[model samples]
Target: MSFGIFQVPPPANEPVKSYAPGSPEKQALKAAIADMRSRTVDIPMYIGGEKIYTDKKHRLAPPHDHRHTLGYFSVGDKGHVEQAINAALGAKEMWAAMPWEHRAAIFLKAADLIAGPYRAKLNAATMLGQSKNVFQAEIDSACEIIDFLRFNVHFMQEIYRQQVASAPGIWNRLEHRPLEGFIFAVTPFNFTAIAGNLPTAPAMMGNTIVWKPAFTQIYSANVLMEVFREAGVPDGVINLIYVDGPEAGEVVFKHPDFAGLHFTGSTGVFRHLWQTIGNNLPIYKSYPRIVGETGGKDFVVAHKSADAKAVATALVRGAFEYQGQKCSAASRAYIPSNLWEEVKNYMIADLESMRMGGTEDFRNFINAVIDEKAFDKIAGYIEQAKKDAGVELVWGGNCDKSVGYFIQPTILKVEDNQYRTMVEEIFGPVLTVYVYQPELFEEVLELTDQTSPYALTGSIFAQDRYAIELASRKLQNAAGNFYINDKPTGAVVGQQPFGGARASGTNDKAGAIYNLLRWVSTRTIKETFVPPTDYRYPFMAEE
Candidate 1:
């Protein structure tokens, strides 16, 4: 057998199609959801290609209607985590030694599977499990996942092709080598795309992974496992476990083979892991790479000359989509006092028009929050705002938890920019607004920049060119993903390269080349054209 020089095709974002009523795509997805909901799926831990069923099981239910049971996934403890870690280590050498082209082909095949046959299945899983509407599922589980796989493969190729410069007498070749040991991927419940990407991104670079998905997202995670197996990813290359945070960390952090952690979840969890790793540094063989994308207190600031209608629309879509569970979801806003009345009315009109219910109904634009805990936390804030004289509940102060974890799209009107609602990350469909004097644009811009500890995503709306320029320069470090005249939420792959800094995460920029760099260590190979048989040089002889 012989090999040819490899070339990667240009990467492009997957086109998102609307699953509107009476459309064939809508019919197919509805059918998929029906089929999935009709049966109770039983999920087990996958270690070294073996399906291990634990004695303990946890029931899975949709957040929209919590009483109905959709499936059950096996509950794992410390022992299962150990088994998963060992499995990843067992497969490390072979996977790392495999030809780079073969490794790339596996994820490419998975991308094709997601784009075609598995599209409806995964999208339906996300809708039922995560309470996302039809469009949300399409863009998240289907389109974004496809883009991650394809673009990551292209990114891996780019890393591999990068070479060190060579002198005349020596040929220097650079090799991008995978980490020496296994990686741990702790993914969040919001995006099924992130769930898939967090693990597969490092695996695409030939490193083995022990993946632990958020309990709320196991339904969709199981579908990804099937896709990977169907696409022929080798056994033990990427192991899936169902252990919780502490259980997984106890086993993974203590192991000498722990080489990296790819995380996308709460900031608290990532920081705890960092602290644990730091305290136990002496036991590990190498300093593990910690890459995490965490919580965000995202914002949108509008200048006096900004278009009222456009600003209102941005707030509606950016803050309410996916029930405002996204890390990049806009939770705070700053508007000049002059335009506040008009913008507030425009926002209220949109909020009143939104219909909230189960994602099975395409007419419903908003769905429930993930689970009971998230529901209670958001409800508490709305209740507090109702009582506090410093703040007023402008819209959506209602919440009902009898059938599902549902909260209306709420907006809080506050006089203080330093209010708790403006500074904290609610991670729900709650937007806190601070109306400022139009003349204090610069001062309010600085206040908005300094309000939150997180610097994830932010936006500005302005018709004045100089004002826009001033905000842009002043708020440079305020967000990793900044938007002008657009919402910060719908970041596309290859185009936006999503991530953020300080408290939000490491800001490696997922779906791009920078993220792939964290997974591999480079080695330089130098070959001398002429061998120096003699030991001494001219300078040494003269000396």
Candidate 2:
């Protein structure tokens, strides 16, 4: 369709705005938050160019201030799921046939829109709805999402430029076509960038999508949809539906036109969806592409030669940021006996100085958990650790949900390396530390590798090169996004392509060309200049 090979505009990571005192960004975001809180808006499902609103409404409230209602989203059932699928399928032909340059332009424009006008609005929505502080919301909803949009366009162009080499008198061409049908994107509540990326990534490769954001993230998701519409994304290309998992899954998984699934959520849910897809393989027109990034019992291990202060800082920030709701958040740690004392003191001091309150307050380092269920689950772990003989409740185990779902940053020091808190994926601000003999560094690495079924993210802290190498070699398979002396979370879009294997879901690294390849089915064409008139070869004549 194009006369010449085209290059997409070069991409750069969006600069993260520091909402410091007296800053314009700070004032703008605060005004947006105030504006959003002043009124309760009605949200609708966007399907095939239509904003479908149903009678079944679900009220959305902030996790840090549960009583204050933000807005209400129209909840749909399985029928709406079917409608979303049909819409995606209906839009597939036109969307796919559009020139790739045009597609790239749309998303690039979307990035500009997000980086400019929609920045404050998106950040405010995330702060109010998902209870992320200003910085967390800025990095996630604004900067990260902007990076995803811009970088993905460049990746798409890179994919198309990849072609097979042709010999003399013949032309070889490679065509990267979109999936046969449509993609179904199921995103989690923890990340706004991820929610936007899941659907748009596939759509950028010319596929249509039915996107289902987490119910708790609907407030911010609606803002993303607004951005998409403003950026000129055609109707039915990416349909947004608000529906429960089971009802949506039953219809989506069973549909023959379901081309692929791009997901981010729990390990359990990913497994269930994979099983359903496998069982329904016979009904599908083609083998559906399954891609997911799931749960993690992420870890932070410090060697005897590691700096105590640095290790403490990593644990405090990596484990407690965003209330430890991130899948890559550090949940467990193994500290050498010689360094445990100093690390403990530093961690305790940091926790003591931290404040816990709503997201509006900039001084509060810790906020409430996502919802009542998450709060209770985290609280249950803290309460159980208090009673367990193998673990000691070292710092911050107070759980008071009277006003909001607030649980203090809790820590458990365990004698047993395989203690419940150490092994389980508690998606909250609960960290379990186990002290090991200084000589047993290698042994502790082995234990860490085998303790958790997840292999999402983990870090090793060591000033000694030999110790770092040893841990890296020993725990090679323990994490997909392994760190040397840094925190496991805060993966940038283009720099660190994220995802993990084992119980953490498929390791098809997102934020890279590798992920874009999944949404496309390539076709190689060989055109010969000269025709073969004879049926027999030269060897036949010799015979």
Candidate 3:
């Protein structure tokens, strides 16, 4: 129904609002949080464009205030997974055949809605439900998700314009067709933006989706669904379900029409799902596209020439923000001994100055982990580090879960480079540092690269150009999103196309055209103005 040759205007990154003191956004967000906390809402599974409730209900509570029940989301089983898949398939034809402009418009409208009317509520939801500070919620749930939606629409337009050159007298056309079946979007609890992007990215490319967000994130996830529906995404185009992982996998992986997976989670879980999909390959109609962004043991390495204060700031902000749950968070560091004292002083001072509490209090820079399981897991790591003779807990080793799941921003100074906390993905506010002799910077680079199987995100802090260049080249394969003189986290949508390889999932570069390309199966069509008298006779005759 697009009558004109449409051009989606190029998009700008959504401006991040600073919920500054006495600012309107801050006031609105606070009011929204208060309003949400005042009542308990019942959330239902959205399957086939309908709200489906079930007997099994899981309580939704803020990690920082676990006793106060915010809501309960109806849980589904294998049956709901099947229904979601059916609904996705049922809507596939119309959605795939929809005019490209209209498809683009829906998501663009969604972006605008988030930036405008839904901004405060969504941010409030993220802060309460995911235990993110106001700043974290602003950057993630509001700005990042809005950026993803708008930027993805622009990227989709760019993908459609790419075509192969044609020979003289032949008209060659390439159509980026949607995958033959539905996409399974398994998202994590860490980022609300990721939960939104995983399903909507594939759906923007005309593929229907069965999206299953983490149970801990469902409270904010429901707000995103409302935005999607209000933005004019047709019923059944994207189905939201709440079910056990194995239950969903059992149904989705075995389905003949399951065509792709967009995932963000743990490496072990991704591996298991991949194996299951491979085992059920014979049952699928087409080879499924498995795209994922998984775990990271991300690093930060410092040279002797690096500014000690700058390095310390990067560490404190990069590793501690959102409790270091981000895939790109700096979990390990290789600090040269020349500047260790200065860096340690700065970090210790910063840690002492910080306060921790519920998200409603803006003064709390640190908040609770997502749940009790996460609290226990992180505490286990801290406990092990305390026991390990090779590592010393230098600062902030407090763990108090009596009220909420809170673990102090813990740091381990390690003698062993290959220490467990240094190599493993803790997925919490735990950063491990190993001080290397200044002269062995190159050897330390190799050590940093080899110590972890992950190549997700890593930063090099060096003032000397030679040292910076050397580290950059030597550790080129160490990180997919490499940072020089800065922290490794905060990869923006349009600027930094984020993802990593090796055990860190596929380096698909989620916000770029490359990620969108995965959802499309291209078809080449060549038309000739005149019929040939003989079937490709020139090569045969010459031979």
Q: Report the C-alpha lDDT of model 3 over 1-543, residue by residue, as the tens digit.
A: 666867897899989888889999999999999999998989999987799999999999999999999999999999899999999999999999999899999999999999999999999999999999999999999989999998999999889988999888899999999999999999999999999999999999999999999999999999999999999999999899999999899899989999999999999999999999999999999999999999999999999999999999999999999999899999999999999999999999999999999999999999999999999999999998898898888898899998899999999999988889988999999999999999999999999889999999999999899999999999999899999999999999999999999999899998888999999999999999886886676667753
Kindly report the root-mean-square deviation of model 3 from the true structure over all alpha carbons.
Answer: 1.4
How well does each candidate superpose onto the true structure, as a TM-score?
A: 0.98, 0.99, 0.98
State, as a TM-score between 0 and 1, how close model 3 is to the true structure: 0.98
- Give the poorly placed runs of model 2, Cα more than 4 Å off: none
Q: RMSD of each candidate?
A: 1.2, 0.9, 1.4
Candidate 1 residue-wise lDDT at 166: 92
Q: What is each predicted model's overall lDDT from 0 to 1? A: 0.92, 0.93, 0.94
**Candidate 1 lDDT by residue in tens digits, 45-66:** 8899899898899999999999
How does candidate 1 fare on TM-score?
0.98
Candidate 1 clash pair list: none
